[model samples]
Target: MKPDIHPVSRPVVFRDRAAGVAFLTRSTAHSTRTIEWEDGAVHPLVDVEISSASHPFHTGTSRVLDTAGRVERFERRYGRTAPNRR
Candidate 1:
């Protein structure tokens, strides 16, 4: 272990804007914003676009891409440019 060479791990709040959820955890990440936590203490606030609260996998709202429809449309427009094997 080295002195004065490691990041400080402290209690910080991560806010998921989309999910409207905030959680406190120990992290080495830093932030310029401040937020008043539920315990009435001010902590460093980090804004995140997505987290476990709003993620597709965690929320079970995953989106399926329309690749088959896209392939059909491409073939209709380009007349099957790929060669077929016997």
Candidate 2:
């Protein structure tokens, strides 16, 4: 281990505004904003647009694309041709 070589990690508050959820975790990320946590401590606040709480995949709301159907449509539009041999 080296001395004073690692970036400082401190408690940071990641706020997911879309999900209205805030959690405290240690990170090297910095923010100009501050937030008062549930423990009555102030931590650097980072606003995130999406998180596991609000993400489509995490929330089980993501759509499964019909790749086979898309391939069929593309073949219909542009007739499927035989592979060219060298």
Candidate 3:
């Protein structure tokens, strides 16, 4: 380990604006904004537009693409042809 070479790591609050969720975690990221946490302590506030709470994948709201249907449509538009297996 080297002295005076490592970046400072501290607690930071990442707030999901859309989901209105905030969590405190240790990060090297710095922010000028601050917010009062649940523990009555103010930490660096980082505002984010998306997080696991509001993301479509995490929320199970993501749309599944119909690849099979798309292939059928393509075949209907243009007749299927054998692929070069060589």
The lDDT of model 2 is 0.96
Query: Can you write out model 1's per-residue Cα lDDT over 1-86, one digit (the tens) per residue?
Result: 98999889999999999999999999988899999999999999999999999999999999899999999999999898757878
List TM-scores for all candidates, in order: 0.75, 0.84, 0.84
lDDT scores in order: 0.95, 0.96, 0.95
Which should have the higher lDDT, number 2 or number 3?
2
Query: In candidate 2, how many Å is residue 67 off?
Result: 0.8
Task: By lDDT, rank the candidates, best first.
Answer: 2, 3, 1
lDDT of 3 by residue, 14-34 (tens): 999999998799999989999
For model 1, the local distance difference test gives: 0.95
TM-score-superior candidate, 2 or 3:
3
Give candidate 3 misplaced runs (Cα > 4 Å). Answer: 81-86
Measured on C-alpha atoms, candidate 3 has an lDDT of 0.95
Count of backbone clashes, every candidate in sequence: 0, 0, 0
Model 2 bad stretches (over 4 Å): none
Rank candidates, TM-score, best first.
3, 2, 1
